[model samples]
Target: METNTEPQLPYMPGLAGVPAAESKVCDIDGQKGILFYRGYPIEELAEKSTFEETSYMLLYGQLPTKEQLDGFTHELVHHRRLKYKLIDLMKTLPETGHPMDALAAAVGALGMFYPHINVMDAAQRHGACVRLIAKLPTIVAAFHRMRRGDRDVLPNDKLNHAANFLYMLNEQEPDPFHAKILDTCLVLHAEHSMNASTFSARVTGSSLADSYAVVASAVGTLSGPLHGGANEDVLDMLQEIGTVENVIPWLDKAQAAKRKIPGFGHREYKVKDPRAKILQRLAEQLFARYGSTPLYDIAVKLESVMEERVGSKGIYPNVDFYSGLVYQKLGIPMDLFTPVFAIARVSGWLAHWMEQLENNRIFRPSQVYVGAPPRSYTSIDRR
Candidate 1:
């Protein structure tokens, strides 16, 4: 036999373009800049559906009827209150910790309060899903308050999901306009097919971990700058630019140094991200109500400059670009941005978790060996 040597296939860094699993939960058409959940267009969902309705659709795979939505809304509202022990746990967390860090820790601790259930039981999984969704906003709001030496505000069941979160965080009821804006933001952020955090969620859930642990893993993933933290960076960039005149100089320096302009590009979007478009409209509407700030003008000019320079390369403003401005106008603290992302994304995370459990498999991908050939071990004292 003749020994033949041939080059092996190149490894895809970061598993780019790899299809790890099948999902009916979300569909993304990157070329068209379209996103859907269970065959419903995201634009339609964001415009017509409330976050509660969207969450139910993502979780149960269809738009709920009036009766079903009523029950689902009731369950979500009823479970919004955190256990007293959980609040005490939040109190003990260092006030200096980032909200994302505090959120992941709090969610992980939820596994302790609500013990693991039968992974295969549909009802038990649904219950866990509801608890995680309901309690996440409370956890986020409590951490926000606790970090600032403010008293924790309890959840008000009378308010809708988005309104209740704002109430808890601000310790006062939000105006209806502000509440609707937050609700739309939540719907926009609810799901994206196989993003970094969602992948972390499904991978963790594949090991038969409880839903809390799975979501905790995702929260950790989203805490990274490359993901959920991008919104904060976008805001920081706009603040640094300060004025419309500074936008051109900043872009020139950034381009010369090859530094990324945060919020200008996304891997999955060739056109402007649909979510970004919606957020842009929301930001404008917010500016109309609250009056456009200097930073919003800077953002608009920066977006125009980026579009002129890089739009042909499939680079455009993403969901992060305008979302931070909207949140800032809504009076959300800068640090809590990612925590709010987690609050919205938990629905998608739970959906992926349940789907992973439905078709169980351990996620153990093989890596190409790129090390020394097999050799005998040497003694510790020997070289």
Candidate 2:
């Protein structure tokens, strides 16, 4: 690695305890269970704004006026198609593959095609952001079809980002209510300060990697359970319980061992995760719309158990806790849950990647050596 700076400083604060150096986009008041993006509360934005508007605010650091948001939305709609080169590359990957894997590969391929793949120019970086925000959903949805022996779904110029995505998945236009729910899901997922995937993106950006490469790295990290798959695990846990009567007992056993109930607690939020509250409300609305399903009832029971069994101050649901039930209530497929997470979180990832690039710093975090001193090299004959 090239360096003008040498003899790097060490920082070995305990994992899950180290304060992040600084962040420009989000503030996590973990004690209060509050999350704000660019100084705006998630609840206020979720209530009054569209996902597109919120995504804009996160990326650009100010909420757009009606016209500004419209123009931004218009440009996204216009650039929905992937470069032909990218689509062809997608055809080469195995058809029976995870959608996130396919997304990672496709994102990496951008680095191959770019003449300035590692360039950090401002205009080039901005263009990269636009392409990613526009193309990611289509890439994810196309991979969904590929896994099922279907052809790549063409992007729709008419519908907005999230609706067009759902339309591609099912080969039909989304109903207004469902589209709204999905859009809200996108807004909720868009940014969460410095979550796993966003940090990966920022780390890559800090290393001077291209945005696509940064995003590809994010796709890899997001495929993990402890980070992005909480909602899916939430469903799996509910399935294991299967009835309202089972919730309390399940919580009692899990809490007795201090086993995490996937969505029940957060590293930051000692209280209720606000995103969970919003999603829980959405879950209720969907329950009212379509009538209660077993999953919804199970989720409610689990929520009650967490707050009752564990002290409310100690354990409350996080975003991942309620999102799966919301998706279940909306009739979305279970396997699509985490990809849905990616689709929403892409906005925040892009925003942070761009932000990190603007004032680049390689994230070479130091490790504290705690090893045996003066180890001797062993020869093969010594055995």
True-vs-predicted CA distance for residue 153, candidate 1, Å: 0.9
**Under the 3 Å rule for N, CA and C atoms, how many clashes does model 1 have?**
0
Residue range 1-383, candidate 1, lDDT tens digits: 33234555568888899888899999998899999999999889988999999999999899999999999999999999999999999899999999999999999999999995877898999899999999999999999898889999999989999999999998899999999999999999999989999999999999998888999999999999888888999989988888899999989999999999999888899999999999999999998978988988998899898999999999999999999999999999999999999999999999888888878898987666587765778998997
Angstrom error of the Cα, residue 269, model 2: value is 0.4
> Which portions of model 2 miss their true places by more than 4 Å?
1-14, 115-119, 256-258, 375-383
Worst 10 residues of 2 by lDDT: 1-10
lDDT of 2: 0.79
User: Candidate 2 on 9-77: residue-level lDDT in tens?
Assistant: 465443456554466788888887788889898888888878778878888899999898998888778
Per-candidate alpha-carbon RMSD to the true structure: 2.3, 3.6
Best by TM-score: 1
